[model samples]
Target: MKKTCLNINATHGGFSLIEIMISAFILALGLLGLAGMQSTAVKSTIEIQQRSLANSLITDITERMQLNRLWLSGAGNSYSIDSLTDANLSIPNCIGSGGVFVNCSGEDIKNNDLYEWKQKFTGAEVNASTNGENGLVEADACIAVSPASGSDGELVQIVISWFSTVKSKDAAANAGATDLTNTCGTANAHRRQLSVETYISKSS
Candidate 1:
């Protein structure tokens, strides 16, 4: 047998510089995407929380009004103020048997309820000069009522407005104005709103 010479060439394989750079770029892009998603999720969560709080506040006032239906049908009907503020809702401390917890009469209760409701916006004690609470900022509420038409019952409309973290040119342009529909018409894009309506029968 004749011996034949065998030549074997072995080449090592590894990533090139360009390949490494490409991988790094891809990783950076993925990280950026993840960061963006996280930011969006946080914003969405905050918005949901704000909406839930607004709903709760609305429900609270609605229940209070229902409880005092008698008063709501009478002098308390004035509760349907177009724009509500702390001054208009002010009331003296509870008097008589119930003390601070329970108001003395229906009117007293209504007053107390209004005062408390205003506090939710101002986030301070009745006598506090400034808002110290971390609740909604610059929150406002509007109440409108239409008298019963035939047998359709009385219509009550509630609108709540609050300032958001976002800014809008339209909102900023109309700042300091008294237009409730354009509450965010100032420069704040973060303005949010919630509105609800209910009917109260004359019998109820």
Candidate 2:
């Protein structure tokens, strides 16, 4: 009688080492994707918030100019500012005693409006928050008042420029695109701008 011996093994039961390795790799990739999405979402949120704030500030200054239309009229009248430092940062006193807002001359109001705008742009209104500044980054603004050709009124163009986290210089290079088109701020690829034009009727 010849007896043949058969060797059978049943030690390994569940998943193999290679299978576990592959699953770990896939899980890591999924987590990485989730982190990337979160980063992109944060950037987009900041972009929207900054743009909204810029528009609000523009509206504020334009309204102030409207109130001072009489002083803003005539071909000789102008307030074209190249940047924030292009003019003095001083503000005229318009508040009477007891924190009351007294009647300020058109010129005085204009000066005060610009001063306050700069402050807000620099995050002066920001309260104590450990997160970040409450205003635009590296803000630069220009308020150009172009008197109409025929003395109809003045054209107020508000251009606010700041550093945009949404688009970086490196990202712009990667996309082969220019981020800045207007001649405001540093006019660099990292700069973003918000502008609006409004016509203020001549009151005088």
Candidate 3:
């Protein structure tokens, strides 16, 4: 019997350079997408926090005003502060004979409340640091009152404005949305604002 010789060829079984490069490209793209999403989420979260804080501050002042019915009853008439500034509010430390918390009078309490509220904006309170929980930026407030026809009630409008680090996309469209021209004190690209309206009865 005669033996026949056969030749066989062997090939390497690993990924080619092109395949590795493609995989690397795909991974890079995925990472980039994730980074973009994270950035957008952070921005959105910041905006939501700011809005919530503003709402809380507004509610706080409103509740205080409601509690002081005498002050809001047009007797003291301290509820109608317009374009209130930090300089406009001043309150002495409320302390008793033995360093206790002294109860202020009706109008005095109103002044104290206004001072405290403005301090939240200016970050002057002990709990408030610069750009702290009180506010992310310089803030201002306004209070307006309108007399109602007959004996219904008085319309009160409260507005809070703040400078925003994030630029507004629709600022032009919302140019006339608020009357807070000097909110940030300068014509900046980023400006945020909130407003609340309520009616206070004359009887209150």
Candidate 4:
């Protein structure tokens, strides 16, 4: 009788239950990380949008101020704040048959033709309590203006403030989120301000 070699293979090269569970756990953790990243991306997008809007608001005010520097500086008394009315701000129904202008609506003056110039930034509800026709710090231009002689300049300060949807605690909890809080405990509000002491030379 020829004794044939009988091979009895006992090598189990497959993964054990513990190893499988561990791999599954690692994969699940990776997926959760991806989800968290997606959430962060969404929040970041919102922050960018808010930032852009704030920038646009500031630009709008500055551009208008520059364009109407005469009025901004009370040049013919045509552009004075006293003349600012809903009609001049281009508010519909504010002008009657005589085209006589009246006091600007609180909302109309606060926007500074931003509502009429562009529809994109119009109707944006700001922190009404903190923001108005006056500057962000509530400085009235009419009161603040004190013409410096021989300077031939009008020092105008333009301020833009908006409420950012980004929450503080949430931002702290998630490092990826934007923190919009200011030192004055004015959380969720970002203010951009600049003072342009432009000299309105008689030539120009």
Candidate 5:
């Protein structure tokens, strides 16, 4: 009997170098996409936070105006001889109050609050100085009590404004500064408005 030699070999199933490299590249691409998405989300979250702060600031002022209706009306009447300026109205003690500030007296509206509000916000500036032309110069509320003639009501006008971190032409020019509306226009610009009107419901 002649003996025959038999040889047997097994092929191992494994990924080739090229396949491994390609898979790594694909994974890298996916990771990069995820990173980009995360970055975008962070930016959006920051923007929302800024806007929320601004809204809160505005709301606080509105409430003050409503609560201190007497102060507003009194100031309007007393300052009738003079005009409302940008400095006349301001957010009070932004830093001291941790964002809560109020002024019972009209004098406090001038600089006390503005000074504090500026310190609270990382990058914010206020320019309120009542000393020029009248007709809602730069005040959040220009309570212009209408002539009673014979009525017992008064008209109050309120105008409010706030600085925006984004949306501004000058902001585009200056990377450091930002505008809220990113557009230029009295109506479109991000601004704090003043609402003024008269009410006969109460007497001063």
Candidate 6:
């Protein structure tokens, strides 16, 4: 009898359960890292928008002050204000019944400017009732005019302060937050502010 060679087929190699689990874990880690990155991007974008809004607000108030230089220069640095929500602020009627422009005294124009500026922050200008809808969180503004040091005119300081949803990177900043930072609002880790200063003279 001739001996016939018997052949056995080798088993195919495939991923084991351990290998599959490891691959899944690595994939999950990568997905989690991607999600974290997206969240940080959103937060940073919001912070940047808020910063831009703050700058715009400060610039607006500064321009208004410059327009009233005749009044501000003669006021002896008395054109100052704090807390945009101050109930004492009186809104003046600068528009006539026919939606016509009316000439107003410098004082009336100043009051109107303040009221309109507050409306911008209060969302009323945007047709929304929410406060701080101008990309600010619990925002308030201050206009402080004082004698300019080594200058021939009054120094006008316009500051816009807001609550920041983002936490501060410096622990000491959060701890040391105060009204001193913005001259209007007390801040914690979430405090942010923008300010501009210019010298105004009556002669100019």
Judging by lDDT against the true structure, name the best candidate: 2
lDDT of each: 0.68, 0.73, 0.69, 0.42, 0.42, 0.70
Give per-residue CA lDDT, model 6, range 1-204, as digits (tens).
999998999998999999999999999999999999999999889889888887877777777877877776565535578677663665667766664558887787777778777766666766564433554777777777778777667877767777766787422253333433434665466777776777766555
Residue 169 shift from truth in candidate 6, angstroms: 5.5
- What is candidate 2's lDDT per residue for 65-151, written digit by digit as tens? 777778776446555677764657766778655646687776776677788778777777563444458988877787776666786
Candidate 3 has an lDDT of 0.69
Error of 3 at 174 (Å): 4.1
Model 4, range 62-180, lDDT digits (tens) per residue?
A: 55555544444444322223211122344445544574547644343434454443333433244345453321231111102334477755544332334444444421222223221
TM-score of each: 0.72, 0.79, 0.77, 0.51, 0.48, 0.83
Model 3 segments beyond 4 Å from truth? 1-4, 93-103, 122-134, 170-189
Error of 5 at 134 (Å): 34
Candidate 1 global lDDT = 0.68
Model 2 global lDDT (CA atoms, 0 to 1): 0.73
Off by over 4 Å in 4: 1-7, 75-150, 169-204
Model 2, residue 143: what's the lDDT? 72
Which sequence of candidate numbers ranks them by TM-score, best first? 6, 2, 3, 1, 4, 5
Ranking by lDDT: 2, 6, 3, 1, 4, 5
| Better candidate by TM-score, 3 or 5 | 3
Give the Å error, residue 130, model 4: 28
Candidate 3's TM-score: 0.77
Q: What is the lDDT of residue 196 in candidate 2?
A: 77
**Tens-digit lDDT track of model 5 for 24-77:** 999999999999999878866655665565455445434443443454455243
Model 6: ten consecutive residues of lowest lDDT: 170-179
